[model samples]
Target: MKIAKLAFGLICLAILASNVVTMSRWSEARGVYDDICYLRQAHLFQRLGLGGLNTNAALDYDGYFEGKMKQIAFAEWQDPIRWPCHNPMPSGKDVMQYPPGTGFLLALFPEGHQVAPLYIAASLIVCGLALSGIAMARTLPSLVGAGLFGALAVYLMINPAKASYSVAPTMAVCAVAGFLTALWLTREKRSVLLIALIGLLLGASVNFRLPNALLAAGYAIYLAVAFLRMRTLSAFAQGLGFAAAVLVGMAPTLLAQAVNAGSPLATTYGSADVVAPAFDLAVLGQYVRDMQFVLIVLAIGSTAWLLRVGQGSVRQVALVVAGNLVVNLGFFLSHPIFTPYYIVPIAMLSLWSTSFARLMQPEQVRQAASLGREPTSLGVPSR
Candidate 1:
């Protein structure tokens, strides 16, 4: 299955255009899920600086109500919903909680931040979508394969049932990119630099959504199994290097957590309120009724992938997919509040894994690099 670069470019553009229009319309109206709060934090970013979302810097601009100020504030949806100051003003219920990844993107504009930076946010999301699209085409050889992959990605974003999580297209795209990055990183031998890069990528995802820390499990397991299989000291060194890099990558988010939640490992939502009983019948029942289609499709597709990619060059891909599913199910089963958007990132990651299996058919074909060649040599016995 081969998609010409031109046709692939057109498809990417179409996806971006659709997302921009949908997000623009949503930005005009009140959204059900949280977005304004992160955009508000972004308004304070330049002045407050990096990792300052939880700091008291916003207090410096309190009551600065000139028309220009009001316009900018209105544009960025800057509410008093931030961590309250000592004077204790009644705040917007919404607060900026996660790392500043999305906030930093939106805060690039100085004035007229515009009912959130829908354009900037949309652009970045579309950019990731394009990156994933290209990666899909490269992994799969045919245009048909690329078209199918694009349809899957677009459907995750456009499906009506998944719309509640539309506030976070960035996370979905990031999940796809993270999957692709893992596939590329593990396609051959690991180096200190490449291992560090993997850490950086996973860390970026964690900063976006803390639970993504689970994605690391797949990598770790793959490393462990590879070391045992090869029984080499270099493999052990590679594993250690990758672990160190993951810590380095996680540092910024940890710093932000310390500032916001007073603990590097804790989230702003760490209170008992959001925790739910394990295997909660009510939440399970709700999900079964509302999310049955998504659950069934992902589970079936992933199972098929597991069967097709049996312990070959794409083992890491399967591990990553399983990790994503575990994290998603873990959260859904345990969380007091599980929304439709919460499952989107997981779905996207699963799609990436499934596509990898489809393209490489790891059960039948392990495309390994030959000496001085470009790695597409299937059944070369080099992996």
Candidate 2:
């Protein structure tokens, strides 16, 4: 087992090194409208600090936005009204349509050299988590599974993740959240701190991509059902704490919305994004034909396997993952747009949670038995 673990760890490290090389060669000016808008948000933070949250077009006095547009030969580069991702607000202010978190992350690095470092840092974090997962595996099969999944997860940082600037950070969040989900659900004693941290991560993810808000659907449903079933103050408190933490985590986005859109609840997105959800067969077919479909199937299969063979906390984690997959898939499948990275977040989250749940199952079962509460196949106490 030790040798096998070491082998997998080395494999994961090799993948990380390759990812770093690929990311280092990336250029921020890819002629993508979204890329410029995201970088503009970063430029705002670098120039104005917290004041950057107000992304009014008038603040582009330095012509950074114009310069980026011109680099791509955009015809209306000088007209803020004609900007690609900026939306016109009712208050007559034009604001970048994206949430501020990605920009905030980019601002951590120096300007003109941001995208490569951002991706590298994110990939490193993912590689670290992959190594941790491998270390936690006790058996050969678990060790192999962790290593393979970890390698795949790290490799994805460059493929679909490279598809969007928002995706890199979002993937890191999902990986962390997945590990936390396993830890929180499997423990014999519940930890409010763990739950809150998970909520905060999920909430922060929304700042990277709006659709990431749907990532919390499974947790919400699970907590609600648990509280309803127990009718206990502890359960209710858990739910309340999670929701509050999520709000706290997403506070920056709310503040950005308030500053740009005149109301915290108002969105800065254009009409195309704010449309009602409708199932388009074409969109569904696109997903079915994409690599993301493979991930979705894997997540579903893992969830079912865990539910079938797992007991105690493992089963609970499976239930949450199952609920999450359903909600996230439902939303993405119905939406009119299809992006390569759209469904990747939820799939990765489910896989990470399921993987950890399996790796930790033996320890959890032993702990439950020691507490005189042997878990039945249905995940309830045998007594």
Candidate 3:
């Protein structure tokens, strides 16, 4: 068992490094290409002084995205070419249509990296890798659970994408961060402060991609169930704090989307581009196939856990899994644009299962430890 654990861990490490190196090697001449479009969307915020996109800039596409080295990482909206809107756009609506999260990230890119998202994308992926690593190390058991969990996390985090700019890296970061947040927030001595902080983190993630609203829904359910179980007014106050922090994090994009997109929820790409009206049974199968091992393990584990036995944070893990899966499944069922990247939250939450499961006994253990009365007769030291 020890040998197998060592071998498994080493393999996971190699896979992790290989994926990281590949991502590190991307450059402008190679990968950035159109990915920087999000960055330019962010730049519009800076150039136009926090107002909506310039109408003429988007409609008049003359020399807007041009330069030597072809370093034009920008877009002047001609028209938002999404479902329900077919005419050539006469306004700048499309330019500022996307959520400001990715754009805000791009705005932080160095002058050189902006035209190419390679470095930025790689950095975000690395951040995700680091967080997932910490999550597994802190939560999972021994060389097997932790090793397999880390391997699964890296595999999900490193999948190829159309651009690391919007879909890939942003979602990956949010998932990794969200998973870690859940682990911390669900600790035995959970507090209103902790709940608010969790709310703040998950709420902010929603503005990154509108579909992340699904994640928000799941989190809201978890919080609701948790507080309801406690049945206290302070628990409700925690909810308010979470709401305030979310508004703080999303102030820029939320306002911009409302004013520029005409519909606060409408993105630059528009709703039609985000979701397909053609709902089919096959899309569900595609999600299953795309998520691969992660979803399979989750499905199997969930059936057993839900039907047979589980409680405490174990049940919380189930909630996270069910919440993310149910919401995303409904969204992706008809979302023609749904890609593997869209499943980051699902994969991430799935990988986090062990961590949450580890929290099975909270209050009694915490109280015992705090009073310096830990049981040592069995010597089965708890992690």
Candidate 4:
């Protein structure tokens, strides 16, 4: 297992280096719309932390930050705040669209390594998700579960339209991080350290994106309730401990948002609470169109698999995914505008649903662990 993980890590690193080179060259030539915005945000993150960037420069959509490198050069040569070529964009100034967590994470590297960090992080996430799927597949005696996981990861990583978007990396990172944490929480019975680690990872996941944090919180609550129902006081206590760790880790980002925007929920793009019909629906429609391929297949497959593997913890996880989808869609429909990235909460759920089947306590696994597997009727395998 260690050797397989090491091999996977090496492959991910190689892919990361290649993708970084490609993205950097692409940025050098003619950067895409979001790349310009992200690179500029990267610069801002380098200069100021979350508070200053959100409060001061977020409203300047057409400021010197909108242009590629040349625009910044012109801005410096002319007026730092005013660039002759800078056009007035309706969206206004671009703050970091994601939560401060991701920006601060990217800021750890040198400016030139900006794109590389995203590439590395994204690759590592996909690899982790793949490994988790493999673990689940081992229990099935068939490749179905693992195959689905691999397909989903590839779809997320290389899909043309999604790859072009700014939030894809976040989607990948949150999905893998959430999956690993979920496995850690469930697989080991009730280990305090593992539970704490799970909570910390969940917090980190949420810090990257707000919706992810919501999803993790829901799952944590569900786990706590489950443990309490089983009368496992220790497990329940561990769940609470994990939740507290998440709160502690997430405090800074939430505080930054409140200080800067008067609302911790206010994202760099806009608010999540209000829905404007015209723009919101139009954007949602466009996003659904671009993502129709994987999204539809994943939705169908996840539902069918969950139905086949229903009851207990698997069902609980499925319910959480369904719940997140409902809530995320509601937010998208209610918002004044939709960004495809907003659908990420749903995507993360879909990935979780796909990977969680292996965590089911199959008879063989239970026997091996000396835990009683649910008995089968008529000599058939346990349902």
Candidate 5:
């Protein structure tokens, strides 16, 4: 399976690489905002370490409407620097509101446009690896589902206007991919130790983008519910172990924030005026109404499917999907505007369902053939 997986992975990588190269060379929207700026931020951090935050940082409160503020401003996507006062720009340095993790990630690239292709390809690969991990985790055959996920990820990567790349969606992709990989690791029963390692990595996911907190929480909730169903003391220990691992990972960032800016959640990317106390309740109410309509349909469909397909690991997929639904609900209850990137948590649920669909495939043609003659129809109901 490893050999087959590698072969499939390489083939997929080649296709993606070619696509990225083509996009790089031929696309009219080269060196655009998100494509250039986000990559520039990653490149800056990867090469310069934390010190790079000093270069062209934007205020977080400016929000997303103020337009491209600066190099680092583009990094955090903060249009307005949310500050204690209306004018938060106290010093020459802009707010580095984004977590240090992405800066650290950005550090890995060569500074400037020289390595743009490498940077874009790397992002594409991260996305590909994420999709591949999700497909593989559900015990799905690589030959079938894995390719589609990679292709979809690549397609998504290519189609976005240049501006979209530098903003929230790119970071969201990384978080989505990371969370899916983490969940896959959990499903394999790798170990609490490994899950802890993943939890620490998840800290990066959460710090780079706030929405990742939702994704991480969704996974944690899924595990909690799964353990409850199993009713094992060890399961609780595992959950604690995972949380500890996450905290262990998150500790450094928090400590850094405290030392550098006096708060764990300081806006290095600048700041935002949007306070938890001041959220537009009216807009949030509308969001909730819209989300409710969507979830109702999904719940109805999932319930119908559950009744038709008897109990098994597949049911666990439903539980994971339920966890994701809760994350979306939380988003709706608080944030007024929903972006395309916000759908990331649900994307994991889609991948989970796809994987489960693969796992439940007949062991052999003969087993499937026999099922037709038997009362059951491959464990699905006959309409």
Candidate 6:
């Protein structure tokens, strides 16, 4: 078993090294409109600090946005109103439509050399998580499963993730959140603090991609159901704590919306993105032929497998994952648009949570079953 584990660990390391090399060769000016917009946001933060949240086109006095647009041969490069991702507001201000998180991450590196380092760093963190998952496996089959999944997760950093700058950091968050979800669900005693931390992580994800807010659907549904059934002050408090933490985590995006859109509840996105939800066969067809469908199938199969064989907290974790998959998939499938990376976050989160739950089952089965039971206080299992 040790020998197999060693071999898999080395394979993961090799994959990580290859990912680093690939990332290093990436060019920041890839002629993508989104990349230029994200870099402009980073330039704003670097220049204006917190004041960068107000992403008005007037801030581009130094011609940073113009330079990027011209590099792509944009016909209207001289006009801010003609920018690809910037939305014109009723306030007569054209603002970048993306959330501030990815730009903030890019700003951490020096100008003109940000994309490579950001992706390389994200790949390293994901590789580390994969290795840790491998280490936690107690049996041969589990070890191999973790090793394979980890390798694939690391390799994906360059494909669909590279298609959008926001996806890089979002992938890292999903990896960490999946592990934490398993840990919180399988513990003998429920911890409010743990759930709050998970909420904060999901909330922070919104800063990267606005749609990531849907990632909390499963957690919210599970907690709400738990509280309603138990009807205890502790259960209520637990749910409340988680909700508050999410709001706190989303503070930056909210502030940006308020500053740019005239209200926090309002969106800075253009009309095309604000349309009503309706099932589109073309969009559905795109997912059916894409890699995301394969992942969704895997997530469903894994959740069903866990429910069939798992006991106590393991079953609870499976239920949460199942609900999350249903909600997120429903939204993306019905929407009028389709993207390669649109469903990746939910798929990865469900996969990671289930993978970790399987690895921890031996210990989790020994713990007392507390989920859906009456708690003593603060939602902690009564000893």
Instruction: Give the best candidate by lDDT.
Output: 2
Q: Residue 14, candidate 6: how far off, in angstroms?
A: 0.9
- lDDT by residue (1-383, candidate 6, tens digit) is 88988888899899889989989989998899889989999999999999989899998999989988888899998888888999999999999999899999999999989999999999988999999989988878889999999988998898889999999999999999999888888776778998999999999999999999999999999999999889988789879989998999889999999999999988999998787889989889999999889888988999998877666677788988989988999899888898999999999999999998877753435332224332332323322
* lDDT of each residue in 1-383, candidate 2, tens digit only: 88888898999999999888888888888898888899999999999999999999999999999999899999998788999999899999999999999999999999999999999888988998999999998777778889999999999999999888999999999999999999888776768889999999999999999889999999999999999888988788889989998998899999999999998899999887887789999999999999899999989999998886666788889999999999999888888898999999999999999998887675657455447565554334221
Q: Where is model 3 more than 4 Å wrong at Cα?
A: 1-13, 29-36, 45-94, 114-142, 161-164, 175-186, 226-230, 262-271, 274-278, 291-309, 353-356, 359-383
Q: For each candidate, how many residue pairs have backbone atoms clashing (under 3 Å)?
A: 7, 0, 6, 10, 29, 0
Model 6, residue pairs in steric clash: none
Better of 1 and 5 by lDDT: 1
Per-model TM-score, in order, reads 0.71, 0.95, 0.71, 0.67, 0.61, 0.95
Residue pair clashes in candidate 4: 59-93, 60-93, 61-92, 61-93, 274-335, 275-334, 275-335, 275-336, 276-335, 276-336
Instruction: Give one digit per residue, the lDDT tens place, for model 3 in 66-103.
Output: 33114433252222342122222335333433566665
Highest-scoring model, TM-score:
2
- Lowest-lDDT window of 10 residues in candidate 1? 84-93
Per the 3 Å backbone cut-off, how many clashing residue pairs does candidate 5 have? 29
lDDT at 193, model 2: 87
Ranking by TM-score: 2, 6, 1, 3, 4, 5
Q: Which ranges of candidate 6 are over 4 A from the true structure?
A: 362-383
Report the lDDT of model 6 for residue 26. 90
List model 1 lDDT by residue over 130-168, tens digit each. 455555554435445545556545544545423432335
Local lDDT at 117 for model 3: 53
